[model samples]
Target: MTEQPSAAAHAKTQADFAANLASVRERIARAELEAGRTPGSVRLLPVTKTVPSDRLRLAIAAGVEWLGENKVQEALQKSEELADLPHLKYSVIGHLQTNKAKYVARFAHEFQALDNLRQAQALQRRLEAEERTLDVFVQVNTSGEESKFGLDPDDTVAFVKQLPAFDRLQVKGLMTLAIFSTDQIAVRRCFQKLSALRDSVREINPDIKELSMGMSGDFELAIAEGATVVRVGQGIFGARALPDSHYWPGFAH
Candidate 1:
């Protein structure tokens, strides 16, 4: 079993969380201003994937209102564990299986990685049954990476056109995971691609405005490229024990 930290250690952990959250917000503000966008235009979604509930609670206490989890089971577990913290909301940011739509329908406030009609239909049925509505972002594979789970950019327009049939699932915007790389130019290209796609889609559906892109490493570039939501994990939660390859196969560290 894992040994629990002492009281001092727990206190230090909370302190670190607050400090990290502040630093990230500061960087976001700077990035937005540098890009000539309003400072608060982009939202920082702290990803709690792989983070334990105890630490997650500390993060919530440290002013994190919404937590993004990459797995349905994990997010459900955390929601149950942190049920008392009613102010906290959850967003499932991973590729969701159709079979797991019920779990998200029952609890998740938003689903950020929506890609296909099958998954949307599954979620719509469950959400309708449960009398719950969920905010959804159409995931676009802007990097054109096969490993990523998102609809092709070319297919997004047609896909969004079909979403209105699923009344329970509200199509709010688009989401993407940029190619993980050290080369800033290459990374920015992915964000730019998504932004451009969003712009094109907006011509038909004005409500589809949010662009969920970027993560701990390249969020600044994402912000400059018009990301409205950046799913930052490592920057706020410290580092994950597993490498990025564990989540994104062939992801360069």
Candidate 2:
């Protein structure tokens, strides 16, 4: 079993989860206000990558409606385990393999890291067979990082133009993993790039509007740069047993 993030009792308590969730929401709301965005314009995606189903109950209890998972199999297992929970939707926010499209097609309500036609086509086929449409985002690698999984900023326009053929894959927005760094300038630059990329791509596909960027440490900066959705895990679920490299291969080794 993947252990809960911290050894401290406070980390495992319902009161702690509730408090943490409220704090995150307040921060998001504050950022939206500072950015001149309308109230609740920014959506907070509570990332439950390593959180167990038992602890997830606490999060759902505290009013988390959507969960972001990095791996399709892990997301599937949790979905099966939490089947009785009402109205909870899963968003697969990590790099997805073409072979795993069936799993995502059946389980996820949305997929946020789509960068290639092969993956998109695979997902479209599966979704068509499943008789469901999937909301997707074209991921952009704005930081110029080789380890990150996304289309290069220069390639995004051409890439998005091909998405129309995959009707079952509803291109709802854009997603990106900014350079994992404390340098505010570098991080914010990433959000700026994705925001710009979204504007350019919107000309080709008007529905591609949402920008999913930022994480636990830099979401405020992302919001300032026009992030419609932020992916946060440790900020709410304490911490995970594995390091980020486990999910983001070749990053921060």
Candidate 3:
């Protein structure tokens, strides 16, 4: 039989994790404050994509309540296993498939990447069928990448105008993925565009209040451009374990 960790070893492990979380929270505060924004304005969502449920429980014990997952299947499994933890908030941060809308909406507190009207409508229908309301963020392709999945600036406005049709789905402003480059100017431009798009949406509907942008690399720039919710993964969890060659999983790039 395998030997379990001794009580002292477990206590030491927990202490190390607690210290790490406190440091991460402090870093977030510093980053937000550097941009002339209050520390509380930025909410830290530990992106526990491939991490197992045991790690998730450890995180919750260390004071992480909000978590982001990129795949519906992964999130679904973790949700079932971690259902006993009432304080945890799991959000779908991936490119959601239309057919998986019902499962995604079943647990996601916020869906941060609605790219088209079709997807939005599908989500609405699913929510109505399930008799639930979902918070959604319309993603914009600010980087103008052909590989990305978001509305063009013009199309995003039109999508916002049609949001009233999806009464059960709450339109919670915009989410964007900036071009993956280190050029500060380029990053700022993309973020600025998303912020402007958000402004336009708010003009049309006063209730749209979230701007879910930024990741580990460019989150500070995103904050400067008005990202109220930042989805940071590696910055919090450190480098992820490299996957095997044959595993062509949904989010395994």
TM-score of each: 0.90, 0.91, 0.88
lDDT (tens digit, per residue) of candidate 2 on 24-97: 88888888888999999999898888677888898888878999998887788888889998599999998899
Query: lDDT score, residue 146, model 2?
Result: 93
Model 1: weakest 10-residue lDDT segment is 1-10
Candidate 3 error regions (>4 Å): 1-13, 243-251
Clashes of 1: 0
Write the number of the candidate with greater TM-score, choosing between 1 and 3: 1
Maximum-lDDT candidate: 2
The better-scoring model by lDDT among 2 and 3 is 2
Cα lDDT of model 2 overall? 0.85
The residue-by-residue lDDT of candidate 3 on 180-227, one tens digit each, is 886878988999999888888888998887888877767777888788
Q: Rank the candidates by lDDT, best first.
A: 2, 1, 3
lDDT values for all models: 0.83, 0.85, 0.76
